[model samples]
Target: MFMKTFGWSFAISAVALIVAFIYGGLEALILCAILGVLEVSLSFDNAVVNARILERMSAFWQKMFLTVGILIAVVGMRVAFPLLIVGVTANLNPVEAIRLAMEKGSIDDPGSYAYLLHEAHPQIAAFGGIFLLMLFLDFMFEERELRWLGLLERPLAFVGRLNGASLVIGLLVLVASATMVRPGKEIDVLISGILGLVTYFLVRGLGDLFDVDNDGDTDADDAGALAKSATRGVGKAVGKAAFMLFLYLEVIDASFSFDGVIGAFAITSDPIIIALGLGLIGAIFVRSLTVYLVREGTLDDYEYLDHGAHWAIGALALILLLTISVEINEIITGLIGVLFIGSAFISSIVRNKRVTAASLPSVDQLSS
Candidate 1:
């Protein structure tokens, strides 16, 4: 099962390693591998969250996730997205942006592509931070049957009963994060943050809108009409749902990639290496892991994995916002996620053991 899922990722990683060596000999290859590891470490929780959503999707859409989705992750997020940022932030044309990126100038130089990307970090952080925060906030606020940290989660769920609690909290957090930024960048953060909020609502709402089962609390006539339409258009409806989910998944990927893409510049300013390392190696493995989790019922086996992933996301959201004002090492970000996931995994093992022990018959009963 592991090989079936991750074989392609390994193959792609090998090819990317070769390309990296060709690009800049041993130095580039080493840097590329480091960046790949960095991306995977930082986005492990992302794979967990993705698996939760992907499990609901059909097998065809899951393949689309690996195929079409990889193109978007690799090309869109790792390559073109940074170029777009450099272009817009520095007022450079796309060609000029490409040339600037190709030059591989010192990141400290104001004229460098890396410098322009750094200048645009505030807006990028604002958008990505808010988007991820909304994801975390939604998860924290949701009333779930299983609560990993019942003490804290119960209270949050109680608060979640308030209308628009997540949105309100997200707005408050955005405003606070904006205040932490430079005075001039406050408006930029606000606008980007608001747009992030809107984008989440738009995508999530569209998914719900297309979902025939999600049309909550309908009258008999309305239900009958929906049932008839569903019977007639089930395939089309499912396709639409999958497409929307694909879009949602892509957007989530983009949000998660913002930090890794920008931080990859620290390793090397060459965009191609970043693409090869992050897009091909890192993103492929993450997607493969997600599919593996879904297919293997890993989430079901490790009950608290989802909770840990969401908590890690919350931590990442905070880290992204912090990066807007102060620089944070990528290592710190990665370690926090690993800590949450590892702890949850251990807790799950203990819980499973306890359940197994309790279910077994006592010696006296067995003798009888």
Candidate 2:
């Protein structure tokens, strides 16, 4: 079972090693491998959260996730997205940005392509942070029977019943970030954060409005109706629910990639290196992890795992917001996610054992 699930992961690793060896011999190989590990460590929480979404999707959409979705993850995000950032921020053409990326790494000049990306970091962080913060906040604020953090989550859920509660919190956090960051960068951060929040509301609101579920509360299970509700005309040609789910999954993946993209720079300033090392290979592993979890019913078995991922996402969001003024270590970010997920797994096991023990008949009762 393990081999079937993880066989492709091993193949990817072997391919990466060979690629690294061909490119720059042992040094590049080791660095590439480390970068891959770093990406997986920082993104395990992402896989957990993705499993929740993927489980709800149809098998066809799920297959699309592994196929079409992997292409988006590798090419669209790993290669193109970084160039887009550089183009927009530095006023360079997208093609020019690509040329610069392939030139020879950012070695000679302090004002290279890599440096421009660094300059754009605050705005990037604000956008990604706000988007992810909304995801975390929205999840927590929603009423759920099963909660891992009862003390805080219950109150948040109660408050969530109020209209626009998540927006209020997101705005407050952005406002706080504005105060902390330098005056010159403050407006950029604020605008980015606002856009991020709006984007979340726009996407999430549409999905919720047209969401098809087994709960029986919704009746828009019809493709025609769902398309009308979601995008007016966007989903008419495609399976409406499936199309919406595809977009939702992409947005979720983008939010996760923001940190990975920016953090990859910390390892190497070369865009191609970042793309090859941290970007493509890590994405493969994460997508595989999501599939494995969904297929194995890992979330059902480990009840609190989803809650833990949400909490870890919230922590990451807070850190990114704070990073506008403060520099945080990559190692610390990765460790925080690991701690949350690990703790939750253990808690689930302990709870399951207790429940099993309680259900068993005592020897005295049997004797009686």
Candidate 3:
């Protein structure tokens, strides 16, 4: 099953390596491999969190995610996104932007690629940080007793019924906060925060609305009705859920890519190198890591892993927000996630041993 899911990953990576060899020569290949490893390591927690949502998706959607989704990630974000950002922000023509990004060793020259990246850093940080903070707060403060908007509870029950309205309110709050606290870049911050919130709520709502209930809750088992609710009588809720899941996945991917995209500026501003190095490496691992999480049932086995990842994501978001006034290293953000995930893994192993030991019969009784 794992092989079936991840077989394409190996093929793709191999192809990428071959292309790198031909186009970029040996140096490019070596750099791509190293960057791939670094991206994979930094993004393991992201893969784990993504797995929780992806595993719940139907097989067809999963395939779409791997194929079409990968194209969007590698081509759209790694290549086009940066260029677009440059064009929009710097008022540079696309051709000139591409030219500036491609001059070999240009990235290291002062006031060249680095200056451009630094200029845009505030906006990138604003978007990534606020979006991540919202996700973190939602996960950390999520009410356990109530599922999906905490409907079982009173205050939350009212809040849950607001459906899409809560998202609007969240946006308003974000806007208000940005305006009050950071007046200089308030507009940029608001735009980033709203985009993140809207994306998350839409995706998560679709997931919740379409989710199948297998735990035997009769009220929750109305799959047909659940599937039908999201569309304005156009499609099944499951379809909507799948679409939402796709959106959710995209947002997550975008958030994960933000640091790498920005950091790639620090490497060599060759758009080709940035695209090939980060895209091939990061894309391959996302697929592999997603499969690993699904196969291992990591979410089910390690109760705290999701929490840890969410916390890490939240911390990253916070760091991004702080970047408005202060710089936060990507390495630090990555290490925080590693530490949290490592602690969760150790805790899971210890818990598993305790459970196994409890289930075992006493040695004296066995001897008798």
The candidate that achieves the highest lDDT relative to the unseen native structure: 1
User: Which stretches of model 1 miss by more than 4 angstroms?
Assistant: 212-237
Better of 1 and 3 by lDDT: 1
lDDT of 2 by residue, 1-368 (tens): 67787788779878877887788788777778877888899888899999887766656677898999988988898888888988998789978898877664553366577777777889988998999999998899888888887999999999999998988989999999989998799899999999998888888777766663322232334453344335322222125666676788888888888777877777776665676677667888898899899778798899999999999999989988888888898778889999999999999999899989999999999999
For candidate 1, the per-residue lDDT at 83 reads 96
How well does candidate 1 match the true structure in TM-score terms?
0.92
lDDT ranking from best candidate downward = 1, 2, 3
Q: Give the Cα lDDT of each candidate.
A: 0.87, 0.81, 0.68
Residue 248 in model 1: shift from native, Å? 1.1
Tell me the deviation in Å of residue 125 in model 2: 0.8
Look at candidate 2 and tell me the lDDT of residue 334. Answer: 89
Backbone clashes in candidate 2 total 0
lDDT tens digits, residue span 34-82, model 3: 6666677668778888887776665666777788888888989888888
Stretches of model 2 off by over 4 angstroms after superposition: 104-109, 214-238
Better of 1 and 2 by TM-score: 1
